[model samples]
Target chain A: MNLPDRHISLAHGNGGRLMRELIELLFAKHLKNPTLDVQADAVTLPLERHGELLFTTDGFTVQPLEFPGGNIGSLSVHGTTNDLAVSGAIPKYLSLNAFIEEGFEVAALERIIISIAQAAKAIDVAVVAGDTKVVRRGEGGGVYLATTGIGIKTTEINLSMSQIQPGDRLLVSGPVGDHGIAVMLAREQFGLRGDLMSDAASVLPFTQALLDLPGLRFMRDPTRGGLATVAHELCRGTGLRVNLDQSAIPLRDPVVSVCDMLGYDPLYLACEGRVVAVIAADQADQALQRWQALPGGELARIIGETESNDPFVVLHTELGGSRILDELEDDPLPRIC
Target chain B: MNLPDRHISLAHGNGGRLMRELIELLFAKHLKNPTLDVQADAVTLPLERHGELLFTTDGFTVQPLEFPGGNIGSLSVHGTTNDLAVSGAIPKYLSLNAFIEEGFEVAALERIIISIAQAAKAIDVAVVAGDTKVVRRGEGGGVYLATTGIGIKTTEINLSMSQIQPGDRLLVSGPVGDHGIAVMLAREQFGLRGDLMSDAASVLPFTQALLDLPGLRFMRDPTRGGLATVAHELCRGTGLRVNLDQSAIPLRDPVVSVCDMLGYDPLYLACEGRVVAVIAADQADQALQRWQALPGGELARIIGETESNDPFVVLHTELGGSRILDELEDDPLPRIC
Candidate 1:
């Protein structure tokens, strides 16, 4: 049957054959991770040795449900896990809620559910408690998924605003704006893709690797508002200026070219797999070496440093002047993920 | 400026003066509740003595955010709490996520947030964490909210389908179909109302009250697809037949009348707050009395009893006919939240 009729019908939410099929066919193929196969009521998980727990919840309502790099299911898992990882927590269990449009394809529903299962498995998490509801046509676009995750804090991973001090080094894992640019490429609004690929990967292992090191003080995944916003949040509370060397940051040629074509700033565009980090000056090189050891983070670099000044994020340009990094004014590409 | 102007715009989601105003003026007014007055980043709450934790999450995307007796905010709090309560948990902490269309009214938003806070207060819970994002105008409806709650479980309370037994008497807390009928009236489809109001109260206390009665075998809040679907779930593993007396179940006059006009069954319609219990025959009268003592459960009744001979749900109709209760098939007034 033809899909994207632009509204959700009642049948989309039925939890029988249609719902099961929708979850299996459309969303699961890409998410073939193992933790998702248990099919339990709730995932009872193991925490770190004597770590305090941290839990975070997030909901996805992106239009189109399916995007260039991922769909809502995978995105929900990544988004919730990222929240915990960034907060220095080892994400272990997840709870989910799905709101389906009426008359949605059973195939599509199966795809989403399986995709969620796969994503959970990929990150060593389980889809524990869940609730599903159906909304009639015109009530919703397609499907919306909300995820809540509980994590245990790793003792050595003390990433906090209070940890920042003068002379701290900043770094990012891999390229930025790939996810946003790839989504725009999928839309084909202006045919702006130099064969871009969406950079959507679960960063739990990569985060755990950094936390294993002795000198790191901060870590965050640049997703929704991107690097500019993340940089601002880091600098806002410490009253320490962040002097970033723009030339040192990693970017793919296609991503930069597409941003030029779309009149968008790559700094504010989203990146799903990238991590922004702040490390002590003495340990910066070792941290960079550790990041470069990972497949996705092979191009990790020292992009900035903390300095004595008003809380500001300054980007040094090739033009021999410095430009201040500002908080993102609006989403560069709405529903890019 | 005029708000909820027939269409949600991009400006509504911008977290500027306009967004704050929309929340303060329109939404807060209708959602008028006391806990919302302080308007902090997170609400603080205290649990009852001996109260344990209960948790549940829900995403409400009903086609029309506004219905007869409640809106998404009211549904978010009550619905999540209902799921947690019936599981024998005392819900205490909540995390919420809101996705809004750009140009949604500042007034309407404030009203929704406040209403949510008020609802949580009424139920003696707190909203601990929240996130909000704005989607471009046409990409999203006015708003969608996801809430996750954490509550304590009492010392000795557990409700599950495995607790069911043969010869147990079935009891209902109050009238069925009021919520479903009220929402239908809100849609103004077949001109229905008067004898209906959304059964959208918090059912935590109601569920908790029955637990102290040692004879209470199983309890469930029948929401989507109503009491029939839940009963089917209860009877899944066990070959126990539930014989419900149709004449004994309470239904509002409006609900019965509307059901007749539309050829809908009251058992299939959704109920937000009412509950169903299976108690030993010896404790059925006391259970009914306990339910009747609570305002939310005043119309309590002994609707049926279980028999080992028949494993399905059979309704003993007012006309002395027997009919099996099948799972709800079509969308019974879809989005009648």
Candidate 2:
């Protein structure tokens, strides 16, 4: 029997002939890999010796589904990959689950699947397993993608908040808030229009550059809550104070202008492809230089320093005044990924 | 700051202070384990020596969110766990990603989370990492769960269709169509109301019982599209034919009644806690006896045998006549999980 032509139907998820056709024609056709077996309910892999395993999961509910620099498909891969990369792991395999609405167009689903395939290929990660489910039209969003990533930690590098010292230096990789602004522009909200693109690329290379740094204490990808929220989390239960030099931080002109027009602070806006690293103060300059030489880290800068006294994040404004950058209380925008 | 008392909002997924509070109060409070660290983006685990790693993913979109015997939370855990169990692995860790609607009630979320914790605890599996995303009210079903399970294949027991041969016996753990019937009854779509409950539970014990059996060739948890679909898959490309005895397959009275009333085939409906196993014909009785002694395997029986002549599933009716059990063409029910 021929599969449905235009829109996805419940039969595609029924685990029968049509579902088998969908998997073969759409998923396997694009995301083919040696480890992916449609007949097997689970994929088996040989464990890498002398390596610790890292596991991470994320859900992509970004509005518009497709955005300026990337779509939800690529974001799903990058989100999980970045999580493992920041934790000092080499991403290897991924499991994807797509919850598609009944009325969603099959062509769009194919495009997203292709993007997912391309993103995984670029990072040398395999889409080893996947599941699909269809909800009634109004009951589901366009498509919510959830990805689980498994990586192997090959290095002895340990990055955690517990190892952070008072003299640690906080560095920001490239500009902030590009992804949030890009999503907002894609929604056409606030009558906003620009050529701005999201910084939604993978941070694997950026993270790798600092992986060997002896003084690296902790690293994180500032995705949903941006750089400031990451800072707040780093010092929340600890007696560490993060003092940020706002003027030294890098920001794209369009992102800065967008933040100015709206009441949103770029520091708190999302960045799908940026990393916040805490390194020793003595090695901060060398780390910044190494990052600047990389492709996505030309604008890397040491923007803050940790103190032993207060437990709050203090931002020194361009006007020489200081204020506490408290944790975000409300949702500035939703589905920004 | 206090978390919202009533319903979930976009703020709860913003990765800000509210999201943190939600995680700490609801998810962390219930699903907390040594591997579930709030501060880490990914969890690190030590690898099991001499064991192959198994990975599986599944999305649960069960309607009504809560059903007679299990809710989506428990279903999510059972679905992924069963997939691994049937693959000859012991489930170790799970990564959960929740896509919640804006107006979903907090009380319901808490209940579901508690159920997830309970289900994981029953099997000694850990929810090592998780993610939460909230979509707008209309864009999301109340809550959709996606889970990825990691398991360790400790033994050399390989179970796959490639190992199946002619004259192999097919055995089922228990009654069929209970999950589908239970969900359909919960929907009240057909004015159906009874004490029918979903057979949604962990199949680890059942799968474990037969792990060391030398006659076991393959095992599968008949889920969506059920026994018929699994039979179709087992013989599709193998030039093998499956012959099933309709009278011998165990069926709950209510499930049989519902299928008869609705003109639905019980073999085509879903089953959550059932396993279809292929064992050597000579050892079929031994496997059946072993399974029948288990708690959920009271009705275990050898209901079918595979042949090498044809590639279709031939069903012998109660009248002693045979017919083809074709693959499901359209969905009789959606979001049945």
Candidate 3:
């Protein structure tokens, strides 16, 4: 073993010799940024002297760590950023906690770290701290990630749902269901694909751009149960009716066809690189154009509006009628983003 | 349907009607908080204008959610808080992400949520956001909790290993291995118990007590792989050696005897609610006294010193011999959180 090994075995995460060797060699070698090398029991980060620090934590258990359009490494970055972004803060630092299965390839681990580093750099955030542990075989499903983000909030922004108004219009940036379908196709679990790409980009910018807009009540990334679920949430939380224009909702032909084939509704599918906005009626058009200007938000459009009557989500049909959109019975797509 | 369920069944964790009904009537009924009502794709929170928010997240998967000192619910809170506390932050908020097995029981779920609420109340941390999902019957073990906490960090405190020197003193806040051993005893798989109770309590006060002490370099709870990993870690990182007086290392007699019986070292075992501190050699005496005055830190002791030799952790054994302390060989105390 004079030459360093290039993979993480069960022992690497077992808190034993291999674990030490792995950290001393692989992770510590590339992760040699200033903070981690301090080797403290816990990190003492460089704190901001002025405003309040915003903090958030998230855990990821998406079955396959590597997926189409993205992997767990990139997802971890986006996941943490999204949390801070929705909290009305600018994510500046992150603490990553990884639980890995034994026998994960060292090459693969390096790839992941490189991916994480690249993603972190892309988002302009730093991986300031981390902890890694290995679970025994048959006990873990390859890998799981738990990341905590630290952000600094300025005095200017306050994004809260309690501030939502009665007549605010709802807008969604870009076409939906791409991310859900992309992962599904990547799994090849369904043996389906057709120009469907995972919309797994970060929403930090889109939301950041709209922060200064006048009367921006609330903004959300339609993940998990997607637009329909979030739309239902608006009505339920604010006791307002939301009437969605079916034609106004952007969708790719491939996503629609796939949804039709699978008996899944595109409206209810997850969208990672999308934004759901609840803005003042007057600024709705401006928000749409602003979103369109961003790389990830080309298909921006006005999807719906909040109303006093009905007090439920009602979708205006392409056939000129309306139908009540109930809360999603179940997630049509799982492990998306 | 009429007979009360004795064990967890598949319908409880399913995201179907049964799952919704169980959450609404059982878990939600007990853990009711304005923020817990979130069903949105992402929760929207209002941050205070002045306070820095600290956030941390952890995934709870300790074999049995219902354990000796606490269940998964409470453990989730404690585990997350410990992570946040070790960072020298004041824990203020938490996000609970639950992955429940399809057949989980409503009654068990209720017990878990109540424990969570109690844990939150005990720490004065609010459960501000959460996500719940149900897996298929065989997809999950029982219930896994991923709790994320947020806390505000004070700007003045600077705790890092770079502060350690050759003459720094080592301290342990309380007896070690109690929590790890207690969990194993509860499993009864090894048919062992020895008056060992869990050291599972909030250590925030103890941590806060030591933050600003002039002698402090860094502190950490000797959890997971316990004191040895951290002791070895201090030396390994800063190129300094740590020599611990075994006679001074506090351990309950029962814990000592049990580790002896199991062919393990108490130094390598886990401590749920203890802190290991590095203090200036001159101030070690007063630091020990302060720790001993606290309920959680009552068993605190000055057990070691930083050195340039034995980059490995060296113990001055009771029998006048020494051993090169290494990392955990295997998970000696599994599910011992």
lDDT of 2 at A57: 95
Task: Go through the candidates in order and give the C-alpha RMSD of each one to the true structure.
Answer: 4.6, 1.4, 3.8
Q: State candidate 3's TM-score.
A: 0.87
Native-to-model Cα distance after best TM-score fit, residue B173 in candidate 3, in Å: 2.4
Which residue segments of model 1 deviate by more than 4 Å?
A1-9, A14-50, A155-157, A212-215, B1-55, B136-141, B193-195
lDDT of 2: 0.90
Q: Put down candidate 3 lDDT per residue, B1-337, tens digits, no spaces.
A: 2224644444333233444566566566666666554443333344453444444445566656676777778877887787668767777777776766666775677788899999888888888655565554555546767776666677566677788989899998888888777777677777776566777777788788877787888877777778888887787677888998999988898887877888877787777678888989988888888888987677789999998765778888899998877656666665454
TM-score of chain B of each: 0.85, 0.98, 0.91
lDDT scores in order: 0.70, 0.90, 0.72
Instruction: Give the TM-score (0 to 1) of chain B in model 3.
Output: 0.91
DockQ for each model: 0.29, 0.88, 0.28
lDDT of 3 by residue, A1-337 (tens): 2323554455555455666666666556655666564243344456565555565555565656676777777777887678678666788877766666666666766666777777787878877666566655544556666666777766577766777877888999889888777777777778765656677777788878888886898877776667887887677678888889999999998888888898988888877677788999999999889989988678899888888886888999999999998776564655554
Q: Residue by residue across B155-215, what tens digits does model 2's lDDT show?
A: 5888889899999999999999999999999998789898999999999998999988888
| Chain B TM-score for candidate 1 | 0.85
DockQ class, candidate 1: acceptable
Residue-by-residue lDDT tens digits, candidate 1, B1-337: 4654533444333332343444455445444443333132122233343544344566776546666667878888888877777766767667777777666665566667767878888887766555566666554567878887766665576555567788889888999988877877776656544646688878887888877888877777877678786666666646688888999989888788889988988887888888888888999999888889987677889999888876788989999999998756566666655
Clashes of 1: 50
Q: Give the alpha carbon lDDT tens digit for every residue of A1-337 in model 2.
A: 3324678888888888778888898888899999998778898965567778999999998889999998999999999999999999989999999999987888888888989999999999999999999888898877899999999887587888988999899998899999999999999868989999999988999889998889999899888888889989888845699999999989999998988989789998999899999999999999899889998789999999999987999999999999999898887878898
Candidate 1 lDDT, A109-164, residue by residue in tens: 66666678778877778665666667655555567777887777744556766788
The superposed Cα distance between candidate 2 and the true structure at residue A136, in angstroms, equals 0.6
Docking verdict class for candidate 2? high
